[model samples]
Target: MSDKNREGKRTARERMLAERAEDEARGRRRKKLIVGGVALAVIAAAVVTGVVVQDQRSKPETPAAAPAGTIGDKNLIVPVGSDNAPSVLTVYEDPRCPACGIFEREFSPTISQLEDAGKIFTNYHIVSFIDRAVPGKGSKYAANALGCAQDAGHFRDYHDVLYRNQPDETNDAFGDKAVLINLGRQVDGLVTPSFEACVNDLEFSGWVSAVQQDFDKSNFKSTPTVLLNGQPIYPKFNNEEITPANLVKWVDAANQGKQVGTPGTHGQSPAPTSTASEPNNPSPKAG
Candidate 1:
């Protein structure tokens, strides 16, 4: 009786061990299947990405044409005033710069007045240095769009609009070509096929790079860097108010002793010969 019971218990234990081994094998097989599935998915994704990249590389490249009115040695400067004006206001700016936006909003009108009066010429050195500092392509793309607008004879308009519609500091909406093209339509005569193509094709990307190269090589420290007759003007004048009146006063001060339009000279000066230049030197209002 004891042998029979012992044999039955031993057989039962053997069967339990065999069943556990089979279960363990099934678990290993399931795990291998899952790992293999994940590996296949990752490989498939890599293949798709490589194909897309290769396709893009295989396409013909269309370099953008140089826009009209590019000045300076590298042809990167966008001039927006009389070449013969008494003073030149050179500004190094990045489209993504918040400070640049503020300067444009506050002093652009005065710049327009001075430009219209033939009192001063405005030179805009657009750059994309922020692309290296920031995480997106907005700075480069927006500057490229401005280059296209320059060719359309609407640089100033488009430039102002870009600043006015500038996205939040964290946003990179300007990176989108469609957004850039849509902004161009607001300026009359800026919505043509060439302008659209220029914005979309990144035609001025090389030009943008050159401009940034010039900027990097310059002595300027930041965007909205303003220079009057090659003399650097501080961004914040008299307690952080860079108003139009302040701009006028600064220009007057810069030209204090020199004759109007004299380059690099200092001191008070008379007005230009043109009657349109009469209001160019408006006295800064008493604060």
Candidate 2:
């Protein structure tokens, strides 16, 4: 009776161990499948993201005929009326945006005069949300072209030209390549081959896009959005209270000699002037 009981128990224990081993093997298989699926999903997501970005870079950009102005990055930003200016306004501008243009023409001109007066000095931080328009102004090839122009020493002139001649958002601007080249030519001895090469080169263009993506993550909800003292600038659009004269007078008050657009008065949101095509989607408002 003892031997039979022992044998039965031993057989039962062996079967249990074998079943446990089989179950463990199944578990490993399931784990591997899950890991593999996750990897595939990650890779697919990356590919799709890349494809969408590239597609944006591919849209035909109306090339404004390269201007023959003395074009180049004007490392110097001039805000109107800036004279011994006590306040500083820093701008993050995207040239292709209509709002940005509005910011420039409607808002910035007065400021530029202040700059001219040495009352307030403004610094510009340019970003590219659209692929076309002012070179180095947006995310793709235009940015590279801008960099190239900057390298040649005409960033500001070129920037102004690009904006002055910007086409409608949906319409195309032809001759930007040529305009850029001609403008580059104005620089004493800009490298022609190198300039052309930069325009065609997509690698550096990616750098522009990468920069914009990084910018979007940090600041406001839209392009041409400005920052004052590292905070967002809001221009008050109250018809009576927000006139250009008031802005100038306000800057005068703030600089009581501290760098302020208006002394006690606050501004509404900054305006944008970009009139170019957006990459992927129109610049999403800063969220």
Candidate 3:
């Protein structure tokens, strides 16, 4: 055989091998695409299933819908800890009040922990004072939004979202209608349609007005007020008791838990123990 022919044969073999390599590469790409698609489908299924499970869990088990016309009040209890909890705490807060925000962030956890353990039951009365901007207008919209959240049975989440995202108290837009709407979206079971409608309804205005009236008639002049049972959990100092840690001090002191030694705070020794059993005010409790 000629040398040229031999060389040509070798070249042909190399070309064929190259083609096979290309084919293998193409096959691998196809397999990769198939695997990626399967993985995506699995992830999608898992997400959907998770959402469904969460929905099932949040649905009212017995469904004793809050009675109609119960706009507010009637021990709207948020279980903090024990049914044997010594007292109910009623907090009147301004969504726009910085002090209130501090209290919500600082003290709420202690109360929440206690509630979860049945040691405390709490009620929240949205005071809507100092609406960040408008003298009275701020609370109106925010309070309306709270009412909407309550109607949706996701008030707890909405309430948390509000305090979690609260802006400075003197500002006007903190709890604006739009802010309320976005906050509603953050909650799992919140109904956007109903929230929008309910927030705008004038029917809930009375409830808001009533809450504010109650505060106006109270012992304290300003907000971030804590009424333990019927007695005020008045702070010894500034609204420093507004922060999460300090708020816990307030609850612990109110509950006689250890004196949490955070700076600028102290625990009050349980109301003299002999001060005739404190009576808690009647208000709507948290979820």
Candidate 3 lDDT score at position 10: 99
lDDT of 3 by residue, 1-287 (tens): 99999999999999999999999999999999999999999876543321111111111122123212222333122222223356666666666666666667766556656565544555566654453223446666776666556555555567677888876544556446766677777877675666677775534665565555555544444556676656555464243434446555656666675322212101111112232332434332221
Could you report the Cα RMSD, in angstroms, for every candidate shown? 14.5, 15.3, 17.8
Cα lDDT tens digits for candidate 1, 1-287: 69999999999999999999999999999999999999999876543322111111112222245677665554566777665666778777788877777778877778877776667767777877665645689988999999888877788888988988998644789999999999877887788988888889888888887777665555454566776665556545545555677789877776676555323111112222333322222222211
Against the hidden reference, what TM-scores do the models get?
A: 0.66, 0.48, 0.55
Give candidate 3 misplaced runs (Cα > 4 Å): 1-84, 131-136, 237-287
Worst 10 residues of 1 by lDDT: 50-59
Report the lDDT of model 3 for residue 25. 100
**What Cα-based lDDT does every candidate model obtain?**
0.69, 0.48, 0.53
Q: Output the number of the lDDT-best candidate.
A: 1
The candidate 3 region of ten consecutive residues with least summed lDDT is 262-271
Better of 2 and 3 by TM-score: 3
- C-alpha lDDT (0 to 100) for residue 15 of candidate 3: 99
For candidate 3, the per-residue lDDT at 277 reads 30
Q: Who wins the TM-score comparison?
A: 1
Model 2: number of clashes? 77
Model 1 CA deviation exceeding 4 Å by range: 1-65, 236-241, 253-287
